[model samples]
Target chain A: MLWTVMPLEAVLDGSDSYEPEYFDVPWNDGGRLIVEKLNMDSARVVRLISGNANDYLDASIQPGTIIQYAPKNQASKQ
Target chain B: MTLSPRQRRSSSARRVRTTPHPALQEQPKTHTQEKEKGQDVLQNIQQLGQTNIPQQLSENGIHTITIIGQIEGHITLPPQNKTTKYEHIIPQLVAIEQNPKIQGLLVILNTVGGDVEAGLAIAEMIDTLTKPSVTLVLGGGHSIGVPIAVSSDYSFITETATMTIHPIRLTGLVIGVPQTYEYLDKMQDRVIKFVTSHSRITKEKFRQVMFCTNQLARDIGTVMVGKDAVDDGLIDEVGGLGQAIAKLQSLIKARESKGGSTDALDSDAP
Candidate 1:
């Protein structure tokens, strides 16, 4: 039950789809999230950001947050 | 004092009467003298091993600059961290560039990356060297290390070496705003531009791998192995120190043949 923030672009691109079984809550309005408080042994509260290319976003991802991704798109193969 | 045969025969009476000065007297060699010589040799070895003093190697024209651990910038990292300070590196680069005796520069990198600006500055210095230079990437050349590795005229990586191509990461307090995003975007562009311009990789290909989300488990970047790096046109070849030195020698030879002075010449001659 590890929770991670999925960027708005990932969700909008269809690479990461929201699922009821994985997350405890529905998608938030913001494109980014700010962690308000952190318990060394337990939990945290985060705020979300609205998805936009111009949105000021911190690119760094936390260590344990596994951002889920769909299989590679056939058109975007490297 | 004992007089020689010629002195004794010619001026025996005078020599026998006069007392020799202590400075002119010869002391007999003893076991302690031999032991002292041995101790001096050991002390010389100890001096060469310890005490970060720079000793000139036997007149070799090749200068080796190692970029080990983290490349530190303006801020001081914790004492426990192994950091290659930019202040130290910048001067060495200048010396290597200015010194005529240094005909070639060999840069060895095994960094996990550090400040983006520091790494780029080092890379730029290496890229702009007039002397032939070669880069050998040992261990891991991750993050900003990638740019330094490719900055040399030729680059090599061991079979087990790896390079991580990821977007620029910022630490400390970061403001979340469109301007921040724009700043990050421009910084990313700078890295991509430098890498693409120096290496064989296309900008599109570099960006693709840089932004790839499938490679790292929790991170959004790609880790390329030795031969994979060469295949992807990031590094020149998969080789170790021996190959790297050979390539450097060849480059130096080629440069010399093309009218570049292999030996230091007096530019100040009137």
Candidate 2:
């Protein structure tokens, strides 16, 4: 229910600029990803908000749905 | 009364310089200037009077911190029991790194060594911090002190400094389960990995030292004196404060040559 902005260069560098596991692939509400405790499944979004993740995301997609990408640098404030 | 002209001639011949060695003749005049500067600095240290560090030792922004007690994790004893916290020291270390006056850091240790986790944590933090650091072992750097010795860019141990490397030991009741034992083993692995990676000693050599059976009466470990520690590659040199400071200066100069600033070394105000 929250969103943060980040730069694309940060994720490419593989640095942990964001809090670990905070960002993830925002799947649609009807979709479900497998959750296994033993698999050590932890999402690591490198806080790439500007280009890569952001451009691929659609914030106004749907209320009950989640976008699977970060917000673009241009529409960040929106 | 006897005419000993031959003996006199021989003595005079010995004193006569036969065209000084070519190497000495080729020496640059600047070399002499450098030598004189070094001598002046030595005299300055002597003039500091007691600690004999000339009042100007801090001239070039070189500051020194002397840790005269054991630096380990929290324990019950008294004021000395104060465990150097990560939060407390992290800021100091960061400040030192960011300060423009501090050219380098000198950590003088006289600890009996405590808290493997805390000790390794500090050592690793120093190992990675982008600053020239030098550690001097004064009295004893035992147990987890092994990592601290190698954490700096270089290290010095006094002739009397003693370092003990022993297997990890815990003094308390523990959960007697397979999972608990597994967790403990993993934690130890983390420590050993950090130590071996940042130091010259290899995993096998470290294993031998950590498991030596005859060193401690109550535990299996190895005790290395100053020179031995250096020979074993635990400490870089067997020297005193001057050598340590000199090494720090050299490193600072190297860093400066690489376009980094050396002013942070002035003082971080604790």
Candidate 3:
């Protein structure tokens, strides 16, 4: 049951046909980031699955952040 | 007069030659790093359509969390709608509870409310927090937002702010069974129990307001403006942000003093 001021139709519009594609990437301090794939190279962060309280404080990894998918070799070089 | 294509190209080439190539100029390492940072910021802006992420205020002991738009639940809302995801908020609350430097919390609400279970979860967390907290309701705090507004140690509503009290309803597909109705009623009771326990409003008064007729157009509910909410014992006061902060600070001070006395007693116990 939903308790909201918004109309039911407006809230559930497009939900039936839309299926989000999310990937779980290992993040800093053993945390995992749930990101929705936008394209091949990048994904938008949806949530951070972490037990560490400090992990939630990082601004760069907050929800809505676009994370670039760098290959292991390229990431290590940087 | 516009220059011919040949003349424009020749002029641009000459200008480029006169102004040494940017990369050829000797630059400090910091300058290059700053440029890269700027590019990253630009890319983030382009991708997220937002200029900057919200930074926690470090200058004060009080942390403010604004609950606006829809309170999202298990299903993510479409991108166009503004939503306060419970996942983001729950972690922040955990961080706030663990952080010793933070003395109080101020929740600012301007929400239409959303998923019932998510809203109740947030409210329960706020109510159980050991630190001093105050909620200031601006604009409108409707539906599930009422429970959240009352969850804090003290709640304030702006003079123009309003709260809509209405019965919870099921959305989407429903089986034509009596059990479904019973389940929905039980879910609603959880919200009513939380709100009535935390605030001064009685369960009877709240239910009366919730089932009130003739107050809302085409809806069975009552809309309580700031002062009316206070008068009805639904909210503590009708004030703005400043008052809410002042109240929180005072509450924090009281807690500190009480803690100090308890410490003194512990020392004397030995």
Candidate 4:
């Protein structure tokens, strides 16, 4: 349920057609970082899903920081 | 034969020249690298309007969490809408509670409020924290925001700030059944209970203001300005950032004096 001053129609406008492209990449020490894909190799960190409190303190993985991921084929080549 | 003084000095100078001067040799390399770094900084400034984004200070005992725009929950609103996701906030609250260095929390709210469950989750987290906390409402803290605004140890609203209290309602996919009404009523009761318990407002007074008809146009609720909220016992005081920080600091100090001394005395005793 929504409890807000904004009209329901205005708040949900374009919501039906809007689908975000988010990826879960393996992150530091077995934690996972959810990122919104910006391109083929790079994504912006959306949030970290982790049980460790220290994981949240890592500046590099903080939300809004951009990260680069290697494709499976590229990793195999290396 | 022994050389003259002048001849000895000339021989030493010639020996020094034979060995390369490292500083002179590295000057050109350092210059190019500095130029490249300067270009990167300039590019960063041009792109992000900031040369270096400031990171949160870990040493500071007080931490701030801002609830702005919408409190997004299960359904992700469109990208155009600015949202404060619960996934991000819940973990941060956990970190704040777990981290030893953090002694106080300051919540700054400027929200229209959204997602009844998400907002309550945040409020519940703040309310249960052992450390002292203070909340400051800058703009409109309406609807679900009311519960959050009062969840802190002390709540403040700027003289110009306002809070709207309204009953909760289902947005989409509402079935025409009595059960639907009951569900909404249950949700509304949860919010009322939270607000009434947290602040000085009573259930009867809160419901009266919530269902007040003449205050808002096209709505059945009251729009409480800063002083009005304090007068109604919804908020503690009318102040801004400075006062909020001062209040949080005092609360933290009070807690430490009360809790810290007993621990010290017990540990020191035989």
| Candidate whose lDDT is highest | 3
Per-residue lDDT value at B12 in model 2: 6
TM-score for chain B of all predictions: 0.78, 0.70, 0.78, 0.77
lDDT of 2 by residue, B39-71 (tens): 434432332111322123347656454433334
lDDT by residue for model 1 (B147-204), tens: 8999999999999999988776544478988898898888888888999999999999
Q: Report lDDT (Cα) of residue B183, candidate 1.
A: 83
Worst 10 residues of 3 chain B by lDDT: B7-16
Interface RMSD for candidate 2 relative to the native interface: 35.2
Model 4 Cα lDDT, one tens digit per residue, B14-103: 012222122222111111366654653453344223332213445557888778888987776665566777877888888878776677
Fnat per model, in the order given? 0.00, 0.00, 0.40, 0.36
- Worst-scoring 10-residue span by lDDT in model 4 chain B: B6-15
Q: How does model 3 fare in lDDT?
A: 0.75
Question: lDDT of model 2 at residue A49?
Answer: 20
What interface RMSD does each of the candidate structures achieve? 38.4, 35.2, 16.7, 23.6
lDDT of each: 0.60, 0.51, 0.75, 0.74
Return the TM-score for each candidate structure: 0.62, 0.56, 0.78, 0.78
Superposed Cα deviation of residue B246, candidate 2 (Å): 0.9
Q: Residue A15 of candidate 1: its Cα lDDT?
A: 16
Give me the displacement of residue B96 in model 4, in angstroms: 0.9
Task: List all candidate RMSDs to the true structure.
Answer: 28.2, 29.0, 11.6, 17.5
Q: What digit string (tens of lDDT, one per residue) describes model 3 on residues B7-122?
A: 11100000112231222222112213656556556756654444433344466678888788889887667555567788878888888776766778999999998988899989
Candidate 3: CAPRI quality band:
acceptable
- Model 3, B4: alpha-carbon shift in Å? 36
